[model samples]
Target: MTTTISYEQAKAYYEQWGVNVDLALKQLNQIPISIHCWQGDDISGFETIKSELSGGIDVTGNYPGKARNGDELRSDLEKALSLIPGKHRVNLHAIYAETNGQFVDRDEILPEHFAKWVDWAKQNGLGLDFNPTLFSHEKANDGLTLSHPDEHIRQFWIDHCIASRKIGEYFGKELGTPCLTNIWIPDGYKDIPSDRLTPRVRLKESLDTIFEYKTDEKYNIDAVESKLFGLGSESYVVGSHEFYLSYAQQNNKLCLLDTGHFHPTETISNKISTMLLFNEKVALHVSRPVRWDSDHVVILDDELKEIALEIVRNNAIERVLIGLDFFDASINRIAAWIIGTRNMIKALLYALLIPHNYLKELQEQGNFTERLALIEEFKTYPFGAIWDHYCEISNVPIREKWLQEVQIYEKDILSKR
Candidate 1:
């Protein structure tokens, strides 16, 4: 009837596999997943000057309780964090800058615009991450930025990314944790491109100029994200995974792999070990893809478990930076955040409880049959019991109980919006 008693019983089962359940829970508590802020408002940031959601991405459903402003967004995020059993980071985009309703273009925006966010982060005891908004702007209306043929347009995005790095540095300095400022551009062609090399060259040059104005690594870390294709850019995307992978390796930067950005057949879980072998660190945007890069809410699917297993087995827990990236306006926004984030944490916990060493040894000894059988058997292990104990100990609601709190919040706080 009690969680402690159930957890003790579960511990014994894992102990038979030479697994340390207590250590697994301790490691799970120490790991922090970065929760994306865009989910709170359906990627509709509070920018004074707005543009249509373009650049090969779109958010559907008119969910009525979307946070309309910075304060409301943070309030909703606070509610979500209260339910998730960990101290996590918040991922922000440049378009979320607050300038008191003043029209501040992307390139001209400064660190001061995000001072409120930094202060709020400090108050909440959370780390912050950032992204440069390269789509949905006049400069990118032609679906080109950082790789545009026009010198003026290309330079504008370069300036914006440079400013974004400075803001990231400010956050890292103020918060005592390095801020990951990731760059994801939407420069591609809907159809076949007459010239692919030229655009990639321009993108490389623009990035060179942006990285030239560098900040201290202690305060800021830079990463580049690549995509297979997007809505408008069906046939060609300039920053393919190969392009950014090579760039990150040569430039000494982190490569951010978005789970949904790769082809349907491609799996980020398989890529993690290879990435860790080459790069000092790797970053992730954990999202689910329905058909294409749909950015669906993450679930405890097989791929999620594989991704977590890769990280834990390789002892790359500190080397991999995990962040959630999904936006669904069909349901309560806060509930979306809670579900996606909690699932991510659950995947990590599940991985932590596995006996990876024994599995590897079995493979090394050419015992494939045993490896497969043991892995499958472990799937039926009482993972839920350990997780419920974690939630109970973390002072968060257990299992579906959090849903009741979300419903109450929706009725009292979200419905009025």
Candidate 2:
């Protein structure tokens, strides 16, 4: 645990640099990061017959204690939320429908399938974000949806997307917060295809159909996500970043940028400023990518800092919707959740404590030399002390102390399962 005197001294040190630790904590508390539900169960929802993990989605570990049902998933989420400091929202995919033993296909899914989730979120005082499960279905056997050649198959996915939005609206109305219903379809091909334009045209038309219904944005907001490539769709992905960027701009909808969905060399931080410049709202799916779209646990690395810095420095924190989209079944699920969520909060707080305007002034005046020096200097500016203080204020365990709780939970709760 961080000592009180040490934290106070660190606060005093930052105070000399004109960074308000109190203000940083207040800003960090206000941001609600949506935690993805798929993390608890490796994207395996409570279906009587399990669906094959297809559509460019695959989890590579046989880690024990994976949630077997909706009840277990919710219980795991509760454990995770207890360890994480701030109140956050829960992100759910349509596949996580609690159908109560009755099998519900993707297209035929209704709001009632998610009634239990809504109630759970309501009771927990956490907002809900939804995503249409466009993968891992019989209809997605060809690794294409919405952009599929057959009209019947495309219509089936369109109906599923429509149903998902309605469910999102229901969740929003019930929870009294606008549910962000994000659509991400893994429609692509492995080998090179001759006619790429036709699939894209089909995809555009299908998206148009999905957005035809005018659901009140107050209840539910729509966001379309893009992918550069995937496990199977390596050669060509239909919903490329360019496609969704253009679609989002033309249709006045929010664009979702998943950190793991882009090229390994390209970070999502660079796009934050550009997206906020063009759109009224932008959404994010924060995940660590290991060479490919391998959903690794998020760490407090330079990419995460850059991402948080862009949002905080540009004054677009409120306009940007932050959500974690990681699925690592290799470790304890609860620990993974706590670690990622805490790291995300820490990154945001680190960004909040920075004197961005002061640095921007140096850049604007063409003082690059001093700007570079101060950038390195600010990195060592008592962030750890401020972080411990923030954790103390938030009433969660400080640093590795949280891990002890996770270990206890694993022994008592997870081991029993």
Candidate 3:
């Protein structure tokens, strides 16, 4: 039976569910949260909230400058790193090359700048998460193709992979943890299919080169396979489940699934199951998906709320790395970061409160149908009241603060109108 309920109906059902909102809050108080840095504004400013929530942060993607060469980037990162709670650690994004863009000359990167990155990371007691710019294409310029057909293009990829490996080796040899080289190839088809399978094959070959380099160096690499649904008919790498899984297995590489990459076309629970099946070879990129756009919004929607909670319930939280891949030119950077992190943590609280027993039962005896029903039941569950109760108990004093912030935001938006 297709059980459909309106938002009000769902909220009402949640209110009636024998769900002790207070107890739920108490339960949520026990879990910790983490935020991705690109979506966050000022890392140092988040110190107060991070301490209150006992959460960590992941400094990744296009945030100010976490590059290997920029002196100002190093200073900014150092300042941000110092602000994190002693108990909660920070993860640094090492590379800065933009995807689907021009090739970055490796020689332009000063080796001294890279060595300085290693020094800062080691001194701060922080961890490293690497995202190398492997794909070389023109930005704002569509109809770009991988350069493998061009000798210069082939050399670019090779040299990029080699430089990335050297960086990883530096981390492994000095820091004791191999840099988690996160891979996301922007290579894809943009027009009529010339050679559908050729790009995929070439992309895999490029990945294999990196994999071989990492293997030889004995570095622990996590190949973050990503997907984009036909940007104007050009097929992108890591576009499908089968493609990702097959490539990972064939290359003996681990997989990183971006939650936002999947749409309504694929069930979130099914994706979770895939991760569980490939638990040994899988890590997750946690973010919210909205229809076709990888909105990178905070995970606040009911469907994703339930799926995220279920994954944590099944003991898969550690295997997942929380990241907010959000980008919007409208909001000031700091405000956007604060709101995004707040929303993510709030969503995480809801996930953590799902009764362990319910999850365990589904795991042992429930079929897909039964499990889905349980999820729906939880989705309709009232969580705002529970969050309020937690605020009271934890003495966070932020319920009304957030409400006021929302009001101001609304006023600002209306003023623009």
Highest TM-score among the candidates is held by which one?
Answer: 1
**Model 2: pairs clashing at backbone N, Cα or C within 3 Å:** none
Which residue pairs does candidate 3 place in steric collision?
40-337, 101-137, 189-234, 189-235, 190-234
As for lDDT, the candidate ahead, 1 or 3, is 1
Q: Candidate 1: which pairs clash?
A: none
Instruction: Residues 124-174, candidate 1: write the lDDT tens digits.
Output: 999999999999888899999999989999989999999999999999999
Structural similarity to truth (TM-score) of each candidate: 0.99, 0.98, 0.65
Please list the residue runs of candidate 1 whose C-alpha ends up more than 4 Å from where it truly belongs after superposition.
none
Over 4 Å off in model 2, which ranges? none
lDDT of 2: 0.91
Off by over 4 Å in 3: 1-37, 40-104, 107-111, 115-125, 135-147, 172-178, 215-219, 230-240, 359-397, 400-417
Clashes of each: 0, 0, 5
Candidate 3, residues 1-417: lDDT per residue as tens digits?
A: 111233334345544544444444444444333334433332222111121100111222443322223343344333332222121223333234222233335423323435655676687655555554433223212322232455456556555556665665656666666556666555555555666576666656666665665443354465655565534433443335567677777666666776656554665556666666755635555565555544545536665565566566666665555544554335443344445555655776677656556546776884667777776677656566555444444434344454454345435542342
- Superposed by TM-score, candidate 3 places the C-alpha of residue 222 at a distance from the truth, in angstroms, of 2.3
